[model samples]
Target chain A: MKIEKEPISGQYGKFKIDGIDYRVYWEEAGQGIPLVCLHTAGSDGRQYRALLNDKKILEKFRVIVFDMPWHGKSSPPENAKVGNYKLSTDFYISQIMSFINGLELVKPVVMGCSIGGRIILHLAINFPDKFRALIGLQSAGHLDPYYDISWLHRQDVHGGEVCGGIAYGLMAPTSPESDKFETMWHYMQGGPGIFKGDLFFYKFDGNIGNEIKKIDNSKCPIYLLTGEYDYSATPEETKSLADTIGIEMIKMKNVGHFPMSENPKEFLKYLHPVLNKIS
Target chain B: MFKSLIDDNEKRSQLSIMAQYLNTSFMISTIENEYLVNIEKGVVKNVEEGPFVMPSYVFKLTAPKDEWLKFLKHTPQPGSHDIIAMLRRKVLKFEGDLHPLMSHLLYFKLLLASLRPVENKNEN
Candidate 1:
């Protein structure tokens, strides 16, 4: 299928919270039950610009998309500090909540992709009442013991110094060579300091699996899409997660880490149930 | 501590046995390939010659270009990045044994993982 990017409009601005000023870029589309889509790391909400172009979705709920701090139109804080690094997750969540509260978006169905999913899962665990539903696409939760460590060792030995391991090795498969995506692709590998900082973020010892189990008691239910070939959260892992959380799990056949982007047709099939549950 | 757990002779023999098994069971060739193991052994290994391709029965990964770019942009030299970029573009091809070579390599990798200080009690 031919995919095209659509134009979106939103107020580009900044907000000061916890003594930090963060650039908040947001766009609104459609008009029913509000749905907020958070994009993943390396890229921004523009990734969802095409998804919003759907007339049916436009007719259903108001769709809001935003860029996280340090990605897309959002700017990383000048003179960022070590303390600021620790608050990365907390800051993003609080900013999102503040944004939701500011717009009076009545418990919108919060959807996230990749790190976006990680952010939403954290939100669901810490503040379940704030959201009506959540749809995590290729949502990354915990590191699998089989987590692709070759890449890790490669990055470690390279000292964040080359693209042979990260870009050409890991990112190239998913990245398109078309001119349209080139700018975003370049922006993706723009800084190594940020990439190095992420090494620590992945060091989180907190068990999200345990937090996911907390959803069993939540009034707000979660619908997760586990990619068949996804090493991040394999079907088995999701099954374990579902059983632990006491929720129905949906597995997408023949899909991987970025199912929504990799195999949209199959991903759409898995998504129908989630859409039904939330709607 | 790791040496105490497994006799050094036993470990060496195990490595030799794995190498022999790989040397005999699979064909080592000029074609690039990959292998995956679940036995707490080698998890990832790529043997490529002139180019990179998604091999069958392995965790298929696209060449990591973003990572390559990050390296090239910061490095003082230019030859390495050019070589990797060429490989990613399939200007090169690789040759190796898939399963047996993986088994042999993993024997060493697993030994490393086991010898490391255990961080989590849940680890087997």
Candidate 2:
């Protein structure tokens, strides 16, 4: 028999945020500057599996990834009513702050993708001194609805498979088959209507373009990285956001929305420079 | 060529469990031609070329031949990447009911992807 184990460690921590209790599931590996990763909507911290296993990244930073409530290993608050999950901006901010404060992480670098990407801008505007820096992958200020999200939660639709199918198109065709399917697999396992709920924040409550003007990157440097192939947050949108904010947007070629998960190797090339500057 | 690709056992198997319930037909209208695809329980029953006065399908996907050419490429560009993307970008238009298409989205997505040439299937 042959077996191997990963260096990553997992645990659950209890926290109270905004009058609600959450048992958040988190995984971590490596040691150095604290790097808190935020996964995309309809997915969880497992998206950072490659980053958690990278030896060089581990040597330079303590990478931590947590599934947001109602995602991955994290369960929705027991006190909450069924089918009432909605991720409001205030609620989302409270959750992240609660988790960070609970763990007593000092000035951790927060890196987020997709909806995670959008929230980091909010974080920067709301709490400039809370982090050392912010990295937004496939981030944008606002996006018009491309399709009717009503299809996502209907009784007739298989929520997980349809979500996965939608996500499949968001990845660059150049990404490896194994990685592309693995990324889609995460969406396929999401709880019903959870993806749509998160989109509420992404598409509606989280439109922070006006509020983001208050972000003084001098206090917390903001790095915007977008993939050319991400239709949800197209490179053009990111570029427009960057232009609005007077910052540069790094356009990653042959990559897409789920950069860290779909093509980690290529993503790292674009990320190393940002990490180095932050360090 | 499209029918043979969809009917291939290996490709049909890749549709997996999603195909079990997808008993529907759809029409694909390119600039120059139209084809009606019929599927039942995950297998392609037939794909018929058309010049008919009236044809029946749950939904119809219409696009220019140039757009289809780009979409069918081994590695499609950003806006042309997927059926959803094409629809979002307005490069592809859909008419008729979308319930069957959206409900069994993965099956349809994989079915269309199977039309790509085998030689470039593995290309990155």
Candidate 3:
């Protein structure tokens, strides 16, 4: 499926939630339940435009996606203090709760990627009753050994090398459409510092893991989805997370981080089964 | 001089065949150990000094032209696949005929498939 650019209707528009101006970008399609889509960090809801506009997905449910603070057309915080450092998990959770409540959404299925996935985990833990189902893509809530070390050194030393590796390494083998693919690749990057801060929040101590354990105790059902070659989070770590939380985890082979962007067809094939179970 | 003429004639024919088959132009920068292939209008231009060890993503070229030329100071030996591979990875960048360039890029995989050295079963 092609990624089509759709203009956002000011359904929710810019509203203040606890002193922060939040711009919610949303489009409603199909009928059934409302699905709230949270994009990866540095990415606005635009990343999910393809999924939102998909004929099959649109036929099933109404999709709502909003840009997180400091991301995509969303208003920056009133205070630069919050902007100085990365946005904390607590800050994000508060914003999400406000967004949901402001929109009057009824415990919609929460789906997120990377940092968005982490937010879903937090939401599930703190506010278990808010969502009917949870979908985490290449999620970062798991406590992995590799995640303990700060990538600050790599950022300082490797810089663009690591950036290029993580960014371009995800694409499939070269095809005739390499140039077009390159354009897409350039657009996918969250610039330099933005991505660094995003990763930092993702690996912030064992907060996410601790939160997940709480979610397990609360008996919140969550579906963990990821690609095979997702170096950021290994399959072993994912399996461990599933075993720890006793939740179903589906691994898509021949893919990497951002599988939805890389191979949406394969992603949907795996995603539909879990979504069906939830529905 | 007579031998050189025969060699040039053979080389010209060989170059034509290589161009038609590969559909890309290859340039190698030895200093950076990078090779850049210019594919214009679905045709591969040069094929001899490539397939070298370089960073991937041919479109994101980093080296400047002067530095690249300096890197190629010494005459390059023939039959270096590494240079072409390097070019495919895009250590250097070039601008040429757009249509042919795209054609060359699109047929990269096919060109690579065909360019594999034939196994010398008789020798080894």
Best by TM-score: 2
Better of 1 and 2 by DockQ: 2
Q: Candidate 1 vs candidate 3: which has greater TM-score? A: 3
TM-score of each: 0.59, 0.95, 0.61
Candidate 1, residues A169-207: lDDT per residue as tens digits? 222222232422332353344333443333334325323
| Model 3 misplaced regions, further than 4 Å | A1-12, A79-85, A142-165, A171-192, B1-124
The candidate 3 chain B region of ten consecutive residues with least summed lDDT is B74-83
Query: Residue A77 of model 2: what lDDT?
Result: 90
- Each prediction's Cα RMSD? 15.8, 2.0, 12.1
Real interface contacts reproduced by model 1, as a fraction: 0.00
Candidates by lDDT, descending order: 2, 3, 1
Fnat scores for every prediction: 0.00, 0.75, 0.00
True contact recovery of candidate 2: 0.75
The sequence of per-residue lDDT tens digits that candidate 1 reaches over residues B70-92 is: 32232211222222333334433
Looking only at chain A, give the TM-score of model 1 against the true structure.
Answer: 0.77
Tens-digit lDDT track for model 3 on A1-279? 999555334354777767757665565555567788887655566667557666767666778888776666665656644325465776777777787788788968888877777777777777777788888887755433332123322333233333333344333332123432442443344434555566566766324645456776245579898776555655556777677777768887655556666666667888777777777
Least well predicted 10-residue stretch by lDDT in candidate 1 chain B: B74-83
DockQ of each: 0.03, 0.75, 0.04
